[model samples]
Target: MPAPASAPAPAPPSPHPLRTRPFRLLFAGRTLSLLGDAAIPAALALAVQEATGSTAALALVLACSMVPKLLLLPLGGVMGDRFDARTIALAMDLVRCVTQLVVGVQLLGGTPSLAVIASVEVIGGAAGAFATPTAAPLVRGTVPEAGLQRANAAMAVAHSASRVGGPALAGALIFTVGPGWAFVLDAASFAVSAALLCAVRIARVERPAPGARPSVLTDLREGWREVRTRDWYWSSLIGHSAWNGAAAVLMTLGPGIAVHRLGGGAAWVALLQTGAIGLLLGSLVADRVSPRRPVLTANIGLATYALPLLLLAAGAPAVVVIGAYGLAQAGLGFLTPVWETAVQRAVPEHALARVTSYDWLLSFAAMPLGYALAPLAASTWGPGVPLTVAALVVAACCLGSALLPGVRRFTGGPDPVAPAGAEAVSLPGTR
Candidate 1:
């Protein structure tokens, strides 16, 4: 028989970032951070609702937290780029730890004034503004470029796992003891996170040349330019903004729904738990599938972001609502890694934080508005009607983006290569 053609050499295995010490430390710290974060909202919501019997008051408290973060996010991004991101993250956590500890102590004494709680939330929100922007840049710093998708997926797993435990545990604590203990737990979690980060260090970032340094205004201007000039990027932001707004409404109204409409805290926790499980599964899918056309896959999946809201609007049974929310979260999970990988790869490393800040600022722009509107609408039309409206809004924005010029065409990050005649893929990690 004729000599068989030599088999093609096997492709080299890609780097696994979690194996590296720095990345492991970063991951552990961030995992702890997310646990605290996930606990805060549910605990805060219950505490505020109990202290003040009005949904509007609850909305105001949450809005106070969100508005500052929204306004300060761009500045936070600038800080992330200019300073040591790790240092900034650590400092922010310490600030959050102290503030939360104080708030929890007060709550332990008695139901504090609504004003006092809101003020504390404001401080926590400010710290969050700086902390949130640092996360992406910090991840980029710790993990290898080739393993960005895996790192992100791993963090998503951490996030989902934390959410699964945090909210339910917080709810149970609120039921048994009080919201105070939940807050204390979160404070402890932040302190732990800070300790982990302090021990793990990275090389100092080089300073920009004196001539090359841009004013904050110039950095903001440049970041905006990058976003607005890109059809896909801007459209994606707009789409996500709508979904965010819808989610804001849910955050404002969901607790009330669980407490009064559905059953109580346990039901709320179940809803969150189901969604968390779906998010976990979907993130695993992202790590495995790295969809061939990431933009297309992400945007297409995003249209489902509002499905749970729609189900809730219909006054579905608890199981039905939870199931829909889980499905929606999974769809959202599919988009998260792809979009993040795209941004990390496409944006210049030097400007990544600023660009990320702009993205966050824009994404959060509509949230406060939705939050402000939710209570008012709930008072007038009830939560279901407004939730239904929010769902439609999400659909309009996301589906509309998919129809945009470049929303489905622009796929960034590590582009995947395929054999001749095979369709293009997003990355090699994807199946």
Candidate 2:
């Protein structure tokens, strides 16, 4: 018999996700989008305060952005799974671009009523909700499994850079050209991001024929089932949700404290922003370091985020507060890439977006309450009281989350086992 031809050897593995054209474009898109995201908070806060002179109005405007995002996050996940993530992302960015452009025009023309600004934010936030659930799915699909850590690190690096630069730019523009130009620039950024996203491609699991496609309820339930089966996942969500509730105090009151108490203006924005330098430092570390128990490592490290609130509540100087924020955010930065890679590795690819939506929902659900309550609490007991409470909440959640049985041994990959030659790390229920 004629010799059977050998199967061609598998193509050599890619060294990194950055080497791939699609991932590179996606990276660019994300970098641009985050810049706009980072800038929006400062701009909106300033504009609302300037127009209404009412702190309640500012909170309502912020709430408008957040509430819709929380409400629509789940449906966004469904869309991510059922359709093209790239297309969903691109369409949402287009809508956001237009919304911001119109708002920018209005802000430039005159100080609109609180109602008008809040209404504009409502539309913008809704678009954000739909857009967010697609992000993890796209990232999960972008690179080979082995490259996930590096891919996430790269994205984090970009995000960190944006955080540092975005706020600086926002403060400058807001201080000089006025808040109006900041909105215009943010709108332009979304357009650029959408264009970049449109160029990047991601592979998707094709749905059944139109007549045979699963109902939305069925899809949601399947996603819910997946969440239920994983104790580590659900527990982590609970921990994150608690932490988010506390974290919101920073957004709700941090800037005001910096301005009113700490002798801050635009410098407040820059100081807060400089915290992302720690994130960049953490990403640099992640690129070189591999964790045997990624979730455990993340848990142990993230407990330090309580420091900034503690220091700020104690009335630390701007430089000191900035240092604490840097330290805290570094822990978060280190957790970001590892946690993401771990989850992507653990979940079946097709259902990741839906599960991610659940993650987003649980994590963010309490933030609006935090925003609503923090200012009121501050008003009653002084701003320091809320900051103190936030510090305590963050410390409790981080330490408690680290103690969960499933979290300690979560190594993150197909087998979910300790790395070769490493013994299993002890947990409450370990053998």
Candidate 3:
């Protein structure tokens, strides 16, 4: 009977080191950090609007915040890949703390000049560019490959929780103590996060072998090469770029549609955000159930985003609109962890920051364009028309990415056991 090949040695158990204390601390720090981050935008927006009474000025402030991220993200990624992520993250947090403290002080005194506010935002954004790419690699380094999905999922939950809670808190604070106090709160959160991170001990890995210290340009070139060679990477990137681009347009126009055409206002916006929060919850649950094949699942979740947008275009009521939005958010939440896990599994730890930065740069490149074009397009064709187009674009991107051969067939992580007739390529920088 040939002993039935002994079931291929049971594929060895996944090495997910979930019980590690440092990982738990790291996760707590991320949760607190993101919670503070989520509060900043809303608080800042309210502060600017109250001070300037100009939506255009508020928009400019937001733009300043985002523009640096788009410009400096790749460089930030390089930094993460080259240095200790723990150190980078701690330093960035400190920078953010100082920026927030300045804003809080100014707000408490009086409305500061727009230039000062914009400068602070720009600095914060630049700091964020350095912080984000480090986050994934730090998590990867803390846990085994088997735990990547769970770790990513835990981070996502923190992000979602922040997204869910931050605005509500900001709104409350803005109404009660005023925007400056909210900024103060954000500063405190960053302080807490920095302290937590300081307490967690991380074992540093040696730098890549001596000759492997490629120049920055060379490293960028290699990172680009790695991405281009992977069908899954390119396909997903293209899809998300299209999806986010269209979503940006929808975000700018949705308010007008709800207020003018649908006769809803702040209530509708709240509903939309609430839906996204619900989706985050659903995603957290999905991650706990299974860690395998996150790419395919993410693709599926992304496709679901189109549905709510389409329903909104079709003139759904506030409840239906909110429900659809929630569903999309949930789907996006599920997609996030899968994508993060895939990146960790495929990219070398040494090069992870660079690759992640590249990914963010390309993925977000279209956001500013979308935000800029939405108003112009709405003026010409009316708001509903542009929103409908955005919905269609999102649907098309999701479906198109799913059709990519590599994306469809991808399973999560590397093989735990050696496969027949395959030479194992050691992870990048490993001897």
Candidate 4:
């Protein structure tokens, strides 16, 4: 009797994602873009005030920027899947660069007209709608599967740091050189980001068989089908949307509570600063752990957010509220990178952007609605009522999602029953 052949050895782990050239380029480009993104809110607000000086005008400009992104995200997702994600992202960077340049030059010349500001914002918003969905695919193309979580954690750290520093940078520029200069610097960041992206080399994805592609509507349907069939993914989206809505409620009410019940604006500022620190630390920690059930773990982590809301509803001391808020933000920080890594690992590469766009759309859709309704609810029933309700909704949705079989069984490897027609692209230097 012949001995059975020994099983083949497993492949050795790849080097850290940051050590790879492609990932480095992608990371640099994305970090620059994120910093610019962080600066935009403050710069835009100042520009609107200096030019139009109306709160309504400010709101309108923000709406102009936001609504288009929400409406066009699905379209962007399709484009990302159909075309080269790197190219699409690079093009959008250039488009946004030009838009910011236009705004900067106008502000430099003196008060630009409201029409000019609004129009540029519209263009930027539309471009962002298309660009946002490409990110997951880009990361998938750059980093190997083994290092995905680390890559995401590094990106989250950049985001956390930017949240702390970007606004301060904007304020410094705005006060010393003027808001025009801030916009110009932001434009320059985009230009630099575009250059970095241009240097990034990704493997060429094979196009689908000729006429294998379907109409735009059909593509949309396919993306929807992909999302609907995944029980874990859709359930997580529900929990995430509830989390966003509840956070909005907190934001709307927290300020008033801090002012009237706590000390004042300083207390709110302390809370924000503490939360930012917690997020930074959480990002650091997320890189260290490997959860067996990624979706369930992330959702349970997200449930920590309910603690702060409950504390606020109970009229806890300012120190207590602030500590809970920081802990909550830390939970979010841990959840985000893990969730993103899980999605990247499990979802098919071909439809990644399209599926993620649905994730983005639904996760964000509730925020504005929450912002609008929270105040109304509070006015009618008092702040405590809405706060308490928001807390319960967040806790319920997160914990309930965790209990689902699909979510529990998800180990953040490839999907066991991935749909037909899913394609995996080959990349160099990692896998």
Query: All candidates' TM-scores?
Result: 0.83, 0.84, 0.89, 0.95
Q: Stretches of candidate 3 above 4 Å error?
A: 1-18, 209-212, 415-431
Worst lDDT run of 10 residues, candidate 3, spans 415-424
Which residue pairs clash in candidate 3? 275-326, 279-330
- Rank by lDDT, descending? 4, 2, 1, 3
What digit string (tens of lDDT, one per residue) describes model 2 on residues 106-161?
Answer: 88988566777788899998998888888877786667677889999998888888
Q: Is candidate 1 or 3 superior in TM-score?
A: 3
The digit string of per-residue lDDT tens for model 4 on 1-431 reads: 99999999998877888998898999998898788778878888989998888989998998888889999999999999899999999999999999999999998999687898898889998999899998888888888778899999998999999888888888888889888887788788889989999988775556576579888898888888888888899998998999999988999999999999879999998998889888888888898887899899889988988998888888999999999999989988898889999988887777888999999898778888789989999999989888999999999999999677899899998888876555555454545
Top of the candidates by lDDT: 4
Question: After TM-score superposition, what is the CA distance of residue 173 in candidate 4 from its true location, in Å?
Answer: 1.0
- Show how many residue pairs clash in every candidate, following the order shown: 0, 0, 2, 0
Give the CA lDDT, 0 to 100, for residue 220 in model 3: 71
Best of the two (2, 4) by lDDT: 4
Q: Report how far residue 302 has shifted in candidate 2, in Å.
A: 1.6
Task: lDDT for model 3, please.
Answer: 0.77
Candidate 3, residue 343: CA error in Å?
1.3
Q: Which ten-residue region of model 2 has the weakest summed lDDT?
A: 422-431
TM-score of 4: 0.95
Q: Give the residue spans of candidate 1 off by over 4 A.
A: 1-8, 45-57, 109-116, 175-178, 201-207, 210-212, 250-270, 312-320, 374-385, 414-431
